[model samples]
Target: MTLTLVTGGTGHLGRDIVDRLVGDGHHVRLLARSPGARPDVEWAVGDLATGVGLSDALQDVDTVINAATYSPIARRGGVRPVDFFRSPSAVDVEGTERLLSLCQRQSIRHFLHVSIVGLDDATLPYARVKLAGERLVRASALSWSVVRAMPFYYLLDKMITSFAWLPLWPMPTTSFNPVDTSDVADHIVACAFDGIFGERTEIGGPQDISIAELGGQYRDARGLHRKILPVPMSEAKARGMGFVISRGARGRLTWADWLQHRYSVTHQAA
Candidate 1:
């Protein structure tokens, strides 16, 4: 059995990845901040900020999948201290660095770092740190692959349901190639098990849509009759208020997202 270690194994994407790995019969070890009732998973209690239990978590593991993020979405409208970005860097970047170092020491076979598509030149601190984490993974002595994915449907689900009673869905004009979390999880698991390394793959939905259009789809999917309101604003303004408002606001559309959308729509139109 392949002993696979998963960081942030309790999160939205992380949980899905864990479930898939466990279903596939891999000996799974999960790094979580708190202990919970995941009976099948070997839980290692550790806070990424403090680096607790990381070494124990990495012990005897053959591969690692990092699916953790310290974004405001995880906090759900609470005021994150300035250290929110710094702390994630410590965990997401520096913590991954530590894990890779340990992997080298243990001769762990593979490392998979989960990153976002626009992080290469993204202005958001979170995306930038994710990019740094990707860099650390690539530069490490251990063999690795970076999976850069687009925004997940969970963001859309949360937006529609959280404000279900609202008259209108307010979103920016920013576009995205939103992907299903399940597909992203499946792809990551496949990469981990197959020892695929040395390149990053940009995974997204089969189609792309503008935030306004995405809002409309979410509303329709949930059978809610809400107007999709697109607010025209500069990127800086959208990002600033988006941090306090919609998760869609903070995301800058990557060339990949843009081109993917263009190609998909053109194909559909033809």
Candidate 2:
């Protein structure tokens, strides 16, 4: 059996990848900072930030899917001025370097990196760090591929949910192609199986919708009617948030489709 190593296996996208891989009978090893009870997969306790237990995790691994990233600003729910300058060097940059070095030493067959779209046009400090990581993969001696994915719908759900209670919802006029995690996972798994090399792919949702429109859909799903205040931002800055997908594989789910399923489940449980 071919052993595959997955970094960030417990995350939103990572979990879906791991599940699909395991379901397909691929020998999967997950690199996680702490122990988890997800069944039918080997767990390697490791910290990407500290480079701890990475060597052990890379042992006998034929392929590596690096989905790990650190973003405190987004994870913590709000961005601060100080966070604007802070890059996720510890995990995304330095950790990628560490993993690639070990992959070379161990003669890993293929390396798959998960990234965000519009890094080149985006102005975010975090985008720069992730772009740097992609550069490392492209320049590495190991056979590598990069998959740039659009923002997930769950992320937008969180953003919209945060302000649903307000009398007026403030949203950027910028639009993005929000996708389902499962769709991105399916693409990653296919790439891994084919052992694709030197290829960069982008995946996004089926339609391009503005943030304000998405917010309105969310409010309607939850039965809330609130005024929408479109936040003014420069075109370049809005592009940094996410880009409209002119090309690449579009996901099967639309925002309205996802919203309907989301609230339908909630309503059923209630």
- Candidate that would win on TM-score: 2
What lDDT score is found at residue 248 in candidate 1? 26
How much lDDT does candidate 1 score? 0.70
Candidate 2 residue lDDT tens string, 83-188: 6676668898889999999999999999999998878887778888899988999899999989999988887787676656688988877777889999999989
Taking every candidate in turn, the Cα RMSD to the unseen true structure, in Å, is 8.2, 2.2
Off by over 4 Å in 2: 231-233, 267-270
lDDT per residue as tens, model 1, 216-254: 655554455677779766766544332212122222444
Output the lDDT of residue 103, model 1: 76
Q: Candidate 1: lDDT of 225? A: 68
lDDT against the true structure, per candidate, is: 0.70, 0.85
RMSD of 1: 8.2
- After best superposition, candidate 2 residue 11: deviation in angstroms? 0.5
